[model samples]
Target chain A: MNELFQKVLAENSILLFCYLIGSITFILGLKMLSHPASARKGNLVAAAGMLIAILATIFLYRTENMSHLGNYAWIFGGLLVGGVIGTLAAKKVQMTAMPEMVSLFNGTGGACAMLISMVEFNKIMEHHPEEMHRGHLLIIVLGAVIGTVSFAGSMIAWGKLAGKIKDKTIPGAQIINFLLFAGIIGLSIALVAGFATTLPVFYAILTLAAIYGILFVMPIGGADMPVVISLLNSFTGVAAAFGGFLYDNPVMLTGGILVGSAGTILTILMCNAMNRSLKNVLLGSFGGAKPGAAGAAKEGGGTYKEISMNDTATLMAYASKVLIIPGYGLAVAQAQHTCHELEKVLEEKGVEVAYGIHPVAGRMPGHMNVLLAEADVLYEKLLEMEDANDQMSSTNVVLILGANDVVNPAAKDDPSSPIYGMPILEVEKAEHVIVNKRSMKPGYAGIENELFFRPKTSMLFGDAKKVLQELVTELKQM
Target chain B: MFQEFAAFFITNYRLITIVILSIFLGIEVISRVPSVLHTPLMSGANAIHGVVIIGAIIVMGSAEPNDFVALILGFLAVVLGTLNVVGGFVVTDRMLEMFGKKKPKK
Candidate 1:
């Protein structure tokens, strides 16, 4: 029996079993993740599969000569250090910073894939140059290129999201990006054709890819980050899938493909929600072009009315149904809790309150939902954009909380507007509209919200948290 | 030429089939996920790709003691891959936990 067990381990049968289990668990976990109730458990189930795969690899994985992989200290030490740092960062990150945090984590994944390609390339060159097949070279080159780009792009995205890096666009920037991408591809083809197999040539390809990645993301404005981040995420997944191909490992293959396709779908979904093509997002640099001169010119003569807090409170207090639309500003001011408090206060007054969440309301996709969830807002009260629009006609009051472009009439009515054709909240459909903002400044998209100048709309000027607090106080007294 | 291609396909049919099927399965499973769960779902998928840690471990284990570059690269890959795996899942769980916390009250 012991001999049979040894044989199984030596022949890699046990490792294969572990891989199969890991793959199955990954599929099941992802399927479970579709619904809210099982999403948490789904994550745990996937984590368990990863644990099994890792332990089995450490214990049972064998080299070509059937020797067990040595170097336990380095392996365990790396795992321990990384595990501790990762857990700490995840635990400490605030909800508002979640987009950057996801970018940072995804960047590390891309870096890991890049490093693996580098290590494997070195190993193949030094040990088995004769066995370097065309397929092997293709996988390595593709992995390195994609991995480096994803890594660099994600880091730039993280920086931009955290405000550490400013949006920078050079003269003829699109042409420059095109040239760099071409150079990387040109170098890769050279390597694959066996014309330039030297490390310097390969490294040159990587360097160009890194540059392209940086420049690719540097000029994208804040409003377009959801698409950029999602695209980078899929790039990382595809890079990892190349690693899976290199190793012919089932678990890695399935996981990588799963992420790649899912990320692709997510990117498309984000683009669809904004009603912009991915090409338009990349080329137009929709949000970063100096706030569109036309925006100022368009709203130049329009006047917006302001509402006092006393009247605002009274209006909401007596309203039959009030729909509250929250945006990045609400998260910036950390007013989700106060907003929820205001909701409760309004509810106590026998007023019906529901949150209208645009798909791209905050910095990232589904960002507003996470913020509201953190504030203990009941999930059912949060209505998506379409549902909110469906109820807009009957809503007695449409309260815009630190939100701007999402409710803009320009998206629908202004044909030449940069944000034209983008689906908005259609707050005009409601009987009354009140916008809360710091000032007349444009939103992240840098567009003047024409909705504010409409007859039924009135601006409530103040910080979202302060205004909400004052309104709560005013409502309680009423 | 056709015979050669067939031979190649016969050898790699399983992997090819897995790759193709997984793509369709991926699109099918999350086709109807509500927009609210998008963040957690994306984060969850990010964590899944951290399975690349297996590849990292394989390289690290198999490299010779004298191969410092390979060892170092392997070590870094392991660290980053672990970070991706651990961090991705933890952050996602944190987000999903918020979603789960208030459900019992409903």
Candidate 2:
């Protein structure tokens, strides 16, 4: 008995030490993540913490029954298969597809949390069906509901962002979604109240929550995808936290809480950047089919003046200061490298060149920075929207490359516009504004840009990459 | 019933404290990040949640062989959790790799 007691005591102490180390490393890693230079090392540090936690659970914490080779095979097999597939996918996916991949991984976390809850519920039902505690049942229900919703919702977000799913809403879909959400809550309460069979009720809640998840995201437009993705990510984190609560594992609990809070903070920041509330994003159903041609056809209000490549080259080549504003169009064209080249050429000509990056310029937060950084653009050349706006007035010329909505004057001048009050690049403040695009079509927000029709703004119509290349060639001749 | 409630709180107060402390720390840390690293940070946090795989392994190990449903669920959880952890870290690392310093020779 004494030996058994000592063994138990030693194991508990070891588990405590591991949890402490894991928590500290996670904290340190996240602290390092605040800066770009140390972010990679931060990730590795957090990964090391995870490894320690996993090792402790496997060797020190497992029960005697789990010592069987069959259990080991399943556990290691999962790690090997998942590790290989995840590594390959991460390696193969392009930077442009990063947001979708993040959503996919977030869904996997949600799935694991949901499965844990389900397995735990089954275990309890089989062993202690007669003495179920309400608190335990509540945690299980919350984990299942939130996790299933996050998993399903993230998949839809991934599909929508990846162009696999169309952003179409069935009539009265919002009402139906509300009803499904209410139904899930009601069923969860009933399960806790012991009014029905535990297993079926649990599954019913899962199914309803899954449906609610799909319906919740189906109506949201592409413009709101980043917010939705962040929100769903937080949901998954919260669900995982509930799983942690169910198991009383300190490391799991800390990790889940950390992710949950961080995701929530990001969601809030993205919402503020768009000047929209979370409720509006969820219910406003902002984005849909590209704004029809009728909006642009009503162009009698103003006409856009087109500038040829030679003229554009002359203007940029002689300019004292030039600001380049890049948007999703640049990303779609994969022209960041060429854009960087243009910056270099202009810099060599004694012109001060800098980038104006709107906070929400690309599909995801900081997306423009990633694209430009990939092309080895100097970090100092990239300016935040506020700083760029501060210098826009004295700027001799502003080159808007495949960027529209962020530069749209409607954000400030037109109160009737949907994107009104949203922060923009204010590129029109420059003396000369040149916009590079394929045509006069509206941007992703499906709104015609008032800046396009301004006298100071000249449309340089073409693919951003080809236009930049042609302009570079023209500048060389000049 | 009151004594049972107190006992529950006594057993779980430490966990509740950890959860609250971690949440505050998370928010504080995340708020300091520049917008440029938001995507990578989000992906990194996603991977951290894969720590749930430990829960899965523990549950599966303790599960009886006859408990087929629990076994299957636990196994799938392990797979999904591993994927989240591995994919999240690798993808975040790839993204951070692109944010290199300016080349000296060039």
Chain A TM-score of each candidate structure, as shown: 0.95, 0.94
TM-scores for all candidates: the values are 0.94, 0.93
lDDT leader: 1
Candidate 2 residue lDDT tens string, B1-106: 4555566678788888888888898899888788777778888887887877777887777777777887888888988989998998899888877775542233
Candidate 1 local lDDT, A1-478, one digit each (tens): 7996679666598788998899888888888887888999999999999899999999988777768899888999889988999999999999999988989989998999999999988887888887677667878899899999999999999998898998777778899999998999898988877789889998999999999999898888766877888888888888888888888888888988888888888888888887788987777566556456545656574898999999999999999999999998898888999999999999998999999999888877789989999999998899989999999999999999888988988898889777798888888999999999998888866666778888999989999999999999999999
Say what the interface RMSD of candidate 1 is: 1.7
Residue A343's lDDT in candidate 1:
96
Q: Counting only residues 3 or more apart in sequence or on different chains, how many pairs clash (N, Cα, C under 3 Å) in candidate 2?
A: 0
What tens-digit string does per-residue lDDT give for candidate 2 at A1-478? 7987787778878987998788788778777776887888998899999889888887778454324224777788888888899999999997878889999999998999889889888877888888777677888899889999999999999999898998886788878988998899899988987787478889999999999989899888875787888888888878878877887878888888888898899888888787778887888445543455326534654777999999999999999999999988888788999999999899899999999999888778888888898888988889998899999999999999888888888889888777899999887778999999988777767777878888898999989999999999888777
lDDT values, one for every candidate: 0.87, 0.84
True contacts kept of each: 0.73, 0.72
Regions more than 4 Å wrong, model 1: A1-11, A288-290, A299-301, B1-13, B104-106
